[model samples]
Target: MPVVLLRLQEATGSGEGGFTPFSINTGLIFWTIVVFLVLLGLLWRFGWPAILKSVEDRERRIQQQLEEAERARVEAQRLLEEHRRMAATAKAEAQELIAKAKAVAEKERAALLAKAREEYDELLKRARKDIQEEREKAILALRREAVDLSIAAASKLLEAQLDTETNRRLVTEYLATLEQQR
Candidate 1:
């Protein structure tokens, strides 16, 4: 590496007065311009076209990727909206089911209440009929007791044995007349 550097310095005449970047040499400038022009022509003919083609292809690929990303995002948004609509529909159906169930339950409750009221009314009617029958029985028993006492008293006042069947009929007729007057 040192031998190459020494040869390069000797070629540039660095030993005479060190290298001066701003030095003017008409021959060196002429050769430098010639070489620069040749290099520029080569790049323009071959390298530039290849570099431009590669850059254009990269730009087109990037644009395609961006478009694909945008399409994917739009599809995702559409799916999200569809999902929300489905959820709303399901919720509405569930609420409707609940409302129907409540209506059915309310109807059943009303029917049960009506049945209970009917049963209570029937029991009350039966109780009233039984009470009426008991009252009639008590009245008949009292009348029979009154008739026996009257017959015994009449027998004692007369001081004679009388036909019991006749006495009973007479007393029964008298009591019936008294009832009609009242």
Candidate 2:
């Protein structure tokens, strides 16, 4: 049989006029239109808004996540700057310490040099005083020897015996005559 004959048969209710096209099918057409309208309204009113709202909420969450990530990045940059400042401060402190140490060392060196100079000056002064004292002692010893030699010569020149009292008188008279000649 033809395919149209089978469709017309299914379209009609249980009856003997299934092969005819003029048979009543008003109720089938009406129910098909009513069910199609009901399905279209359900999709428009219920399904579409729920799907769209889900997409909008997902977009909002994604935006919030992006903002949080940006905040984290800015915070990390601030921490990095803080670390750099601390490192620079430490370096400056180290340099200052080194300068202070150098100054202290210089002071110590100057003090030691001054002490050495003072000790050398003291020793030199002592040496000069000792040399002067020795010179005076040497001159006194030479004078004593010259006096003894002069007395022996005078005794030899007398050529005659002399008493103690006469010797003393002669020495006194000679000394007085030498003074008058000068």
Candidate 3:
């Protein structure tokens, strides 16, 4: 043990001179490079594939989310356009309905006015016909009265000593004159 300790102390040169800790040792450097190469190879074979796969999956997920958002935006825009078109169609239909209603109302008013005019004309015709009939009845009554008065006057004249043939001839002439004047 004492001999091994003396050899290790001589190898580090720590007995007679103070050695600089920053100085490179060739054998230690060679062993460190060999250990580093073995560790790098182990990590490349066992750990790198899983890390790379996880990163790629995360990227794909993000891209899919972006595509879904874009599709949603397009669908919203289409719905808005459809709503506007429907609103415009409804407005046009309402206007058409209003116009049709107005037309029907106008037609009904015209029909009512025409019916009133026809009734008024019929009433006027009836009034004129009634007036004409009354006038004819009055004329017939006046003719009957005139005939009765003439006959009475002739009877009185005959009682006062007029000839019957002359009285009858005068009454006939007077009746003819009255008819002509009428």
Candidate 4:
């Protein structure tokens, strides 16, 4: 390495223009152009195609990922819409069930009220019948009592033992006539 460096320094120093960066050498220029062309050809044959293929693969992968993301977004939106529709349907069904339940309750309440009214009417009719029967019994007892008293008073007033059957018939007929007049 040191020997090569010394030789290069001697060659550059012996040159008429020395090692000016801008000084052009035809041999150096020709060799540099030849080397540049060889390297360019090698890159075109091997390195450039490999680099291009890798870039294309990367771009394809990015495009596929973007497409997949778009598909997933669309699927998510569809699922969200389906969920919203299901929720609305469930809400409507619940409201329908509530209305049906209310209607059933109202019907039950009305039936119960009707039954209660029927029972009340039956009780009132029974009470009226019982009252009428008791009143009839009381009036029969009073009529019997009045008949017995009239017989006793007539017997006392006559001071004689009158035939009881005959007196009773007479008194009953008189009472019947009085009732008819009233």
Specify the highest-lDDT model's number.
4
Error of 3 at 123 (Å): 1.7
Provide the lDDT at 150 for model 2: 78
Candidate 3 lDDT, tens digit per residue, 106-149? 99999999999999989999999999989988888888888888
Candidate 2 — which residues are off by over 4 angstroms? 1-75, 137-161, 164-182
Candidate 4 residue lDDT tens string, 1-182: 76766666766665665764444567898999999999999999998999999999999999999999999999999999999999999999999999999999999999999999999999999999999999998999998899889988886866664556878799899999999999
lDDT of 2 by residue, 1-182 (tens): 55766667676645675435645468878999999999989988998889999999999999999999999999999999999999999999999999999999999999999999998998898888888888888888888878888778877776454656788899899999999999
lDDT by residue for model 1 over 1-182, one digit each (tens)? Answer: 76766666567765455664434557888999999999999999998999999999999999999999999999999999999999999999999999999999999999999999999999988889889888888888888888887877876866664556878799899999999999
TM agreement with the true structure for every prediction: 0.42, 0.42, 0.50, 0.48
TM-score of 3: 0.50
Candidate 2 residue pairs that clash: none
> What is the lDDT, from 0 to 100, of the residue 120 in candidate 4?
95
Give the runs in model 1 whose Cα sits over 4 Å from its true position: 1-75, 143-182
- Which of the numbered candidates is closest to the native, going by highest TM-score? 3
